[model samples]
Target: MTWDAVIVGSGFGGAMVAHRLISAGARVLMIERGDWVTRGEAAWRPEASFELTPSYARDIPYRCDRGGHGTTIGAVACVGGPSVYYGCVSFRFRELDFVGDADVVADSGAAWPYRYDEIEPFYGEAEGLLGISGDDAGDPTAPRRSRPFPFPPGELAPISMRVVETAVDMGLSPFHLPLAINHTASAARQKCVACRTCDTYACAIEAKNDVATMMIRPLVERGMTLWTNTVALRLEAEGTAVRRLVVHRRDSGEELAVEAERFVLAAGALGSPHLVLASKLDELSPARAAVGRYLMRHDNAMIFGVFPQRPDPTRRFHKQVALHDWYFGDPGAAEGAHLTKLGGVQQMMTPPKELVRAHLPLGTKTLLGGFTEQLTGLLCIAEDQPRKDNGVSVDWSIRDGYGLPQLVIDTSYTARDDLAVDVLARRARQILSNMGALLSYTHRVKTFSHAVGTLRMGTDPETSPLDGDCRFRGVENLWITDGSALPMSAGVNPSLTIAANALRAAAAMVAR
Candidate 1:
């Protein structure tokens, strides 16, 4: 059965595209690499890390370049992709983000072909569709919204209030993080209980308004067909058109050819480029050199504040407060001269005792295990500049279990990236200190959780792999609506932007 549109990967991008296309009366088929996650007590267990859980894809390991040393990184492959385990912090990029700095463009050749107005309405649509709850009153950096958020921000937890108080005392305005979760009681879904296991774990009560819960389930009911555990091997292209997608059904152990009138590549920044290279699409593209270049993942780290007493005696969710005072360069401060395009900082929940013990040294593990409740953290996310050398590539010499070349990642933070994160971390440490923290520990994030910009969209076919509308330069029937299409990694969460752009791209396809 040929579909009107075949979508690969069901995260924010693919889900939004499918939702829009399906609503427009198009027959859609979604192919996901992993099956739907089983939401239960096992998924919310405090003793285990989600990385070691069955939901994470361990078989399709990719080599990540970490400061010259290569390490295997696990990939998330579930139906909703990483959204299943996300913290639901949905944010819209500011207007300044659309037009990148001239210095940045000179360095990375990164520029958004379209402006913020082009996709502004779609951002509202996405927020409404995802049931995003937020208040823009305190967020100075919040973009102009066409309409208010779907729901008002929920009440802050005790731990979040403490951080908010400290930030207020420091003359910094802190706002409630825009969250895409079921915070209100309704017949359609259960309200969030504010559990401790949120950021990296699947919501056992189906309260988190993830892509799977908000988009995929409703689309399936609306006649869209979804195939789980289906790995898209390669796209069979003819001239400038994609003919069919060859996929392997993990459950049946059979390979199948799926045909569709249109193909949407939303397999994230890494997976989409790997598929394109494996299929030799670059050989036919004028923008071949840009296919897997200009990768940008936000430089991120966590600053943990060790308190004398347990911060959260009740152990409730407190990933709420967000501060963006240092988003733009602050000329008044000494270090502000070096910081031009930094990101925001948000409150993070204390890690479970099990996780603390698992990662700490032998003697320190037992010592810190008892002090788990006394640790609260702040996550600093800084916008990292794109570089040509930091991107995804396929290694022809090595093949994975699927007989395809192994995917290799080449990425490292630039000096500016490090500086931006360092400034934000210093501010975070200060905030923790003001909150009566005895000591603070900084831990740098190595995972590509916020990765973007592998197959950037721009006006020039000679420089960018995708056109302004997210169509591949040579492949007429193919479109990329994932993180890969983003030209610049804005100083905010990219999930909402990805969803809005996917909606815009789907509208373009439907209109054509």
Candidate 2:
């Protein structure tokens, strides 16, 4: 059957397009590479090991071609994508992110073709659909809103209260961070139980608004095909249009062809670029150089804070407060430094010891036993300056167990990104310091979750693979509606932006 649209992955972008397109009276087929994420009481158990379970995450080879360096890429491989395991921090890009300011733009021709105002409506829609709970006016760097969030902000936790108090005492504006989880009973899903297993683990009770629970599930009865455990092999294009999609049914081990009027590639930053290059679609791209370039992972870290007293684990939620004071840069910072307001600061939950032990300092790990109860984490996200040479390449010599080529992620940040990280760490230290914290340390880490800019959108086709509307530059029927479509690396998480852009991409296609 030739459906109206065939979405390649059931992530934020894929789910948004499938729901909208099907609701508009068009047949839609959503292909997901992973199996359906099983939700049960195990997901709610605070000490459960559901997140790193083989069913939830898949490991692929990530090699750096420049230095022949390699590492395992652990990416979420479920129908709902990474949204299922994320911390549920729902944030919109700052206005300067879209205004083409020099701070946000990268030298490899990274500048969004449209402004924030044009995408504000979609941001509102995404927040409503995801059931974002927050005080609209609380966020200082928040964009001008058309309407309030569907759900009001929830109360702050004990740790957050102290954090906010300390920040306020220091004359820093601290506000409730926007979160996608359902806080109270509403038109959305169930209210969150405020469990400790939220960030890394999947929500068993359907409270953490993943696209599968919020968008695609509602459209299942309205006529949308959700094929889980199905991997897309390649897109067979006839001249300028996609003819059909070749796919592998993982459950049955059968290869098949699915036809559609148009196609949307939302297979994530690494997956999208790999699919294109592996399919040899770059041969047809007008700007082949732009197809799989400009890789970005926002410089992110977790600052562990130790206090005089133990933090309450039963508090409603740990990630309640956010401070944008250093988002632009603090005045206390040294003068003449190129550091602008850096990134975002929010409360973070304690990670599993097994996962964090390796990243922690040797001296810090030995001292962790006595301070475990008093230790809490604060997440810091910084804008990563996009680099042209840092990107994903198809590793020809290496193949995965599925016989597909391995993905080589050759990515690293610039000196500017380091400055942002330094600023963010310094600010976090100041806050934890002012509160009479015993010990505070910043541990930097990057993974596939925050990956973006692999197939950026821009005004010039020569520098970007997708246009402002997110359509492929040379292929008329193809659109990229994932995090890869984002041109600039904003300081906050990219989930909200991915959903909003997908809404925009769907509208442009439906209008045609």
The candidate scoring highest on TM-score is 1
Instruction: Give candidate 1's error at residue 90 in angstroms.
Output: 0.4
Q: For residues 263-321, could you state the per-residue lDDT of candidate 2 as single tens digits?
A: 99999998898888887788777778987788887888788877777665654468788
What are the lDDT scores of the predictions, listed in order? 0.87, 0.80
* lDDT per residue (tens digit) for residues 318-437 in model 1: 998899898885554556465567889998989888887776667778877778889999999988888888888889998888877888888888887888888898889999999999
Residue runs of model 1 more than 4 Å from their true location after superposition: 67-70, 359-369
Candidate 2 segments exceeding 4 Å error: 45-51, 64-70, 103-106, 186-189, 313-316, 358-366
lDDT, residue 501, candidate 1: 93
Task: Provide the TM-score for each candidate, comma-separated.
Answer: 0.97, 0.94
